[model samples]
Target: MTTAPTPVPTPAATELSGGAGASGTATPVPRRRTVKLRGGSWLATVPLFAFFAISFGLPAIAIAIGAFTLSSDAETGAGTFTTQNVTDSVQGAYWTSLLSSVKLSALTALIGTVLGLPIAQAVVTSRFRAVREAVLSASGVLANFGGLPLAFAFVATLGNAGEITKLFHLTDHGWSLYSFTGLTIVYLYFLVPLMVLSITPALDGLRVQWREAAHNNRATTLQYWRHVALPILFPSLLGGYVLLFGSAFAAYATAAAMVGATVPLISRSIADALSGNVLVGQGNLALALSLDMIVVAVVVMAVYLPLQRRSARWLS
Candidate 1:
């Protein structure tokens, strides 16, 4: 009489049987759980959104609105909408200063682009990894190591009383810190590092095969740069230009310290307006100027959008 074989337990039921005795206890499987998001992520994001809006966006909006409004009368709490501020900004002191600022930014961008290319090329094409690492590290440090401290460093190095200046007896030929040339020099100190960082990737994007092919074709140095390197690196160069333009445009501290005189650069102008006496309605102009900055920032961002799109397309 062949009795039916004992039924084999299913995988779900079978456990503790690899080496343990039959009397050994089997472990129960943990129940699986399904978690569903309540679609509250958007709601959860409200606080952060509100915080930025109140802190940054709202203030910007208020400044813009103030830019378009006349100062409120201290006694009567009366004010009117006017175009004078905008007109003044366009036609008065702001226009010339704005032009100067634009010119300075353009010059700085050009210089940075021209100088940064070789440095970036060197950093990218170097066979020695240590050299590349050193350049990258130094670029990072120098890029962020500017402001008042940088100005002082320059002074200590090149000032009439400076060690190097004195060592060279440069006192016979004094350095002019208050000139456009001086501003440009200080700006280059900040600008070159930015260019190096910005263009390094573009320089790297130039494949060795392209250079080898160019050489095989008997391409001259200028020909290689014109035909092969420039097209590949154009996007990075444009990006570098934009970066340098924005940096020089919005620069405040270095220019301020170097100038030592109240030059009407946009940033200094804005600073003056903002730092006006609080005892009077001077704060209103400051708010107006802040809005002006917001407007300028918006325009700069607008310029950036097309370049970014082009870079994306090229990369893709």
Candidate 2:
């Protein structure tokens, strides 16, 4: 039997192993020193960190400080501090406005979640790519389409004397577009689309193999979703709800333009306070109101971050 030729070591392997040289002795070869990156790659994020400090951190600090400072002190740089502004913020008309904003945000978020989830699922499951593309594209546009133009469009189409109302006798049935319910409807216009964009990726992340396994186990469609899909998607759904809540909570221009003082949203109150509509020095009250808003947002973020981490862990 012919013996197999001895395997030859590659040049790289020879160098690494200190292979025999012409002297018939092992010659040690120095291993190349790898340039260890000492966290310099993190320097790339400096600009982003600086931007947040300037735009977000600094402003947030200013808001916290201004919330405690008296209006007179604010003007004179005295830095005199008190809790009266914060206390006053949650009382009387300010309290009423804060409650109203919370109610509106909760209502819109609930309705948006319920409606948007199915629409997003349908788009993701559909075989018609063109239709899905069209819907997603429209959703992207409508999610950002708000403020003055949206208010104008809705007013022109659904307001009491608007042509659609005139055509359908909507006002005859008490379908006024200037009321709280009307505002909810208008807010849902953008919020539902925003939900679509937010949750579609999560729905898509549902692996086909999951469904196949469920089917193999004789799980009904509802059973599969209940036992498999919904649980996995719960975190993402909650995150979307929180996002929608914040969007509605912080909305200013649309409510300001459409409903004016009638809605009693906190954002409207902020505008009134800041513009000296309440009183010249009530700008301090605006800062207090802003502090209340910041607290609510912080709480919402606290809830959202935990859910987000859970979602990433399970989905990935």
The prediction achieving the highest TM-score against the true structure is 2
Model 2, 182-297: lDDT tens digits are: 99999999999999999999998899999999999999999999999999999999999998999999998899889998889999999888888878777777999999999998
- Candidate 1 TM-score to native: 0.75
Give candidate 2 misplaced runs (Cα > 4 Å).
Answer: 1-29, 73-79
Off by over 4 Å in 1: 1-56, 75-78, 169-174, 277-280, 291-301
Error of 1 at 246 (Å): 1.3
Q: What lDDT score belongs to each candidate, Candidate 1 first? A: 0.75, 0.92
Q: Write the per-residue lDDT of candidate 1 for residues 214-256, one digit (tens) a residue.
A: 9999998899999877875676687788888988887888877
- The C-alpha local distance difference test score for the whole of candidate 1 amounts to 0.75
Give the candidate number with the greatest lDDT: 2
Q: By TM-score, how accurate is candidate 2?
A: 0.91
